[model samples]
Structures are given as structure tokens and as C-alpha cells.
Target: MITSPDNDNNRDEPMVFIVIAKAYETEGGQPIDLHVMLTAPDDDTAVRLTLNALSEEGFLEADLDQIGMITGAPDEEPHASAYQGALEGEVAIIRFA
Candidate 1:
């Protein structure tokens, strides 16, 4: 669901990673859930990219809870949009505030 940074993969493919995170827009503000979707070769890269995206989105702090790979296209609203964005080399975040 996401594009690889180098545009290459060992098997000519990258994995879609969904990072579940609790993020704060401002210091001491209420946390919101961010489902960050991206593509990377490995989990490490996924986590790093997800964090970086969150930071760029103005999240001051983030608590990463889980990282999972999505093998199929999501059939819902935010997930569907996020997945589509990820495939286009964008870190798509579904925010639940």
C-alpha cells in the first residue's frame, strides 16, 4: 500500500506497514490516534518513516503502540484513502481525534 523509498525491493516488492500511534498535536494536549500507513523494506524503516511523517505533521510526541503489515486492500474510508496515499509515496495518516 506504500511506495518504497529507494523504489526497489529484494523481491521487487515492498511491504505495507500500518503503525498505530498515539500522538500529541501540542505539548500536554490530548492524544489522538494516528494510523500511519507507508511502504518499506523492513519494519525498522517503516517505523522510522512513520515517526518522521508524524513529526512533519506537527506531532510533538508520539507513542508507538504496534506495527503490522497489511497484505490486502482495505475496504473502508480512512484506511482506503491512507492505503492509496501510501502507494503513491505519501505517508497517509488516518487521524482519530
Candidate 2:
């Protein structure tokens, strides 16, 4: 769970991001769609781990999105290293060494 180092210091750490998925059914009436939101760690490592766990459990469509480099404010606030890797050949592969 790639959490901020201050997770113990502060009780307001954001550990997970929400992902919304849905399924729809249509009959002679109005179409009804069922929506589900899943919460998982926002970092790459936890995302990969969760995906792998789901894959092992037979879930195939769940995947991760890459949001390249981010620009942060030039203040004294502490920051952490980001997940390293490129989205090679359309696959969001994260590498940690």
C-alpha cells in the first residue's frame, strides 16, 4: 500500500482511489445499468498487486491507467518518489527495484 511516509503521523492519508464499473441490461422497458465503485491503492505497486490478485481470481478486464509525470508546487512540502516505468506498447507496466 504505497502510502505517504506520514501516514502514521496524519490520519488523513489517501490510501485508495475509486474506480467505477458498470453493467447494463435492456428489456422491452427502459435500460437499467448497475454501477459499482471499487477502492484500491492509488500507487502503481498496490494497483499492480490488486490487479494480479483479481487476475488470479479470474478477473480479466481490470487494468491501470498511467498519468505520466506530474508537476508539483515549489514549496517546502515533503514529497515521495514516483513509480518508475513507461507505458510500453500500450501496457502500463510499473517497475520497482
Highest lDDT scorer = 1
- Candidate 1 worst ten-residue window by lDDT: 4-13
Per-residue lDDT of 1-97 in model 2, one digit per residue for the tens? 9665745434343333222222122233332221111223344654555455445544445434332222332233211111111111111222221
Candidate 1 shows a clash count of: 0
Per residue, candidate 1 scores C-alpha lDDT tens digits across 31-87 of 998899998878999999988989998999999999999988899988998888888
Cα error, candidate 1, residue 2 (Å): 31
* Distance from true location, Cα of 40 in model 2, Å: 7.6
Candidate 1, residue 13: lDDT? 49
Off by over 4 Å in 2: 1-14, 21-42, 63-97
TM-score of 2: 0.27
